[model samples]
Target chain A: MAQKNKLQFIILGLLNQQPLTGYDLTKAFDTEIGEFWQAQHSQIYPQLKRLEEQGYITHEITISGEKLEKKLYHITAIGQTLLGSWISDGTPDLTATKDEFILKLYFIQTNRDPRLKAMVQEQLQLHTDKLTHLQQRLATVFPTKASQTANYGHYLILQHALGREDYYVNWLNQTLSALPKR
Target chain B: MAQKNKLQFIILGLLNQQPLTGYDLTKAFDTEIGEFWQAQHSQIYPQLKRLEEQGYITHEITISGEKLEKKLYHITAIGQTLLGSWISDGTPDLTATKDEFILKLYFIQTNRDPRLKAMVQEQLQLHTDKLTHLQQRLATVFPTKASQTANYGHYLILQHALGREDYYVNWLNQTLSALPKR
Candidate 1:
């Protein structure tokens, strides 16, 4: 895979923490990993099926009346083994594929609408808000936890996100101000 | 587009600086934007074609005897206008996506291989190397030219890339050391 099949590993990693349905997995992604990792139901569902077929996971189909049903996935011993192998063997390249900020900046000079500038400003604010929330969550999750080492790792990633967002907000302000008035 | 066609704009952006052939454009991406942006010819050629079809760029084909030919692209007036609009419009939601380092760390407890630890160490070194290069490039590119303001915008993007890389390196080192020795 051009990208590591980390989605499966992510699912395994989360399930290793606790059992979850596909729906629950999606929610976890949004709540816990949304900032640094993103997945759509489209990508998640297929991977879930693949994991089951490969015997790394087994699913229980729960029927809650005619109108409600869900498949909950639990890791198998083989799944744990596979996930362990991946964790040990997977050398995820640190390289990121694309960034929207640089993309927009590349073409910013082409835009004619003042609203475009405002949109960038809005994005900066959104990122700042997210960074704030991530930091708060980190504090809540790690407060007095014995895993000081893991907490430090989490803090590093959060700090990077925070730093990058701050850079964007600063750049947006300067770029907007420097643009010739429409 | 799910992803903004940044590659197209990147081509237009560089052509705005000066017309360049496909090989030259690839080289520029590697040298100038490699820290924050990347494109293989597989991506660039198709985007160039699309840009030409959209009247954002025009190309001249030059033949260098048998099996050797090149197409040079220059931004059209409309291309310049479009690029400007994209810039002013800011970018699409600057949603940060998956970080491989975090994914690897999350699964690190599963693996027991010494090589896995070594792999993370290698990645830490690579990220450090990249961060150093990005810092040097930023110092060279910014606050020196008449276009220093514009250059600063690009520098901010590069800074984000560097900051994120630094974060990954820190995380990798901490996580690797924290792992139980085999």
Candidate 2:
């Protein structure tokens, strides 16, 4: 059998932690994994079904509160094994950065359009917003980094995001100022 | 009509500078854009064919020697227009970070395997190697920062990459030290 994609494994990882319906999985991805990973609801539902079909996960249908039916899925032992193997697998390709923003920024110097200034401003705000959200999440999730042993990876990643955003904001400011005078 | 993917425009941007064969384009990407953008020869060839079919680029078969003919592709006016618009376009989604290492590192805390230290070490070497490459490229290409006005974007992006790899190396070292004694 072909190896599952990262999204499938990400779903498996989430379900490995706790039983969650498709809705709950989507929400968890938004709040928890949104920093380093993100997926749309459309993408999640299909993967959840595929995992169930492949015996990596199982779901139970339950009716709650008058016609509200939910399929709560949890990882199977097989899924746990898969997740464990994936986690311990010693390869991570770090060279790939498929970021469109970087590409745009790289070429922006060649672009003479006046609107480029506004674009840079907008990007600054976006990074600012993301940094703020990351700070809020870090504060809420790990009130004190002392008790963060089990979730040390998450704590460190949050710090990394903060540093990265700061770097981008500073770069964006420099780029804005470097734009040719109108 | 569907918007052309970023690779097509990236190709256009390169050819806009000067005509290049498929092989030459691949090498340019590897040496020049490889740090921020990367595409294999297989991907580049297909995209070149597609761009030719789409009329965004044109290729000329030229004979250089006996039994050696190369197809050199150049960006057309339409391609120039497309590239210009893409550069000036205002929207850039920054939430996405497709770094596999980040995902792997995110889940590493749960992995109890002793090999995790080796993995972190490997990552450090990779980043160090990349940093060395970037620095060399900067020195050779720029010579002096004052003469880099035409390539300011490239200069800035190189700095960004240096900062990023440094960040990664530091994080990897911290991770290595934090790994449970084995």
Worst 10 residues of 1 chain A by lDDT: A105-114
Candidate 2 lDDT over B1-182, as tens digits, reads 54447888889888887899999989977777777777879899999999999999999899988879999999999989988888777665764676555666666454355656766787789888877887787788878856466666666677677777777777777767877775
Candidate 2 chain B, run of 10 with poorest lDDT: B106-115
TM-score of 1: 0.79
What DockQ do the predictions score, one after another? 0.33, 0.47
lDDT of 1 by residue, A1-182 (tens): 47567789889888876788988899876776676788888889999999999998988889878958888899999988877777666454555546766655543333444455676676767766766776677677756646434444444455456555665566567656766576
Candidate of highest lDDT: 2
Enumerate clash totals for all models, in the order shown. Answer: 9, 0
- Provide the lowest-lDDT 10-residue window in model 1 chain B: B106-115
TM-score for chain B of each model, two decimals: 0.73, 0.84
Off by over 4 Å in 1: A65-67, A90-92, A106-123, A146-182, B63-67, B108-120, B139-152, B163-182
Q: Residue by residue across B1-182, what tens digits does model 1's lDDT show?
A: 68666777778888988889988988977777765677888888888888889899998888888867788788999998987776666444656566676565554333443455676676778778877887787677764645554554465466556666665567667756767677
Estimate, for each residue in A95-116, the C-alpha lDDT of model 2 and write its tens digit.
5666666666666444355666
Each model's lDDT comes to: 0.70, 0.77
Error of 1 at B23 (Å): 2.0
